[model samples]
Target: MATEDLMRKALEALGEVNGPMSIEVIHRLVDAGDVEDPMSIAEVSDLLDVSAHTLRYYEKIGLVTVDRDSSGHRVYGPESVRRLVFLTRMRISGMAIRDLQHYVELVDAGEGTVPE
Candidate 1:
């Protein structure tokens, strides 16, 4: 196969992970275009079948922070993308929304909680 054709196939393998990342962090991951990072929101959505609004809500409630690009666009790095996958999986495991929020709060507080 030609080099160009191989590259094209590789990009195609990227699939929905390629563009339309719903969250900033996810976008950054996709933009980064490396396995070391997370894929874009579009990729995550395609991978997990979740809606963009769900991710937006996660950001709204401080569950996720998507860094912005110079153009004021959200950029998602590998960590954020990985976190998304984890959170999505947690939801699937019957984790309550409040628990998730608490977990996020602990993370925000540098892994310390107010104690039971």
Candidate 2:
């Protein structure tokens, strides 16, 4: 099945669940095998439905860390793509940039800060 189809079905399943859902649940639902290959900025932008400029801005603001290919173009790995997915979702849910930044900082600080 297509990734989009899988995501749609996953979302439908999620909607049926009651109570607070963790990010890991959503991650598993949306991951859908696209993480196996590294993608360019354009590919990530298209997959996440965000613009290249926004991706660049995210990177610039330290929200994500993307590697560069041999020719110096951005290459997003699985983890980076996963992070972007979470970031985009949070943005869609109305998270402010500063709050997102702080959240990322807490996340980067490690699992010990989970309560924060």
Each model's TM-score, in the order given? 0.59, 0.72
Compared with the true structure, model 1 gives a TM-score of 0.59
lDDT of 1 by residue, 10-115 (tens): 4456552355422343334434323465356676555555677888788888888887767765666767776777787567445987999888778768735656
Which pairs clash inside model 1?
24-74, 24-75, 24-76, 25-75, 25-76, 26-76, 28-76, 29-76, 38-78
Report the number of the highest-lDDT candidate. 2
Per model, state how many residue pairs clash. Answer: 9, 0
lDDT of 1 at 106: 82
Report the C-alpha lDDT of model 2 over 16-55, residue by residue, as the tens digit.
2332333444554366336778999988876776789999
Error of 2 at 39 (Å): 0.1
Best prediction by TM-score? 2
Q: Candidate 2 — what's its lDDT?
A: 0.79
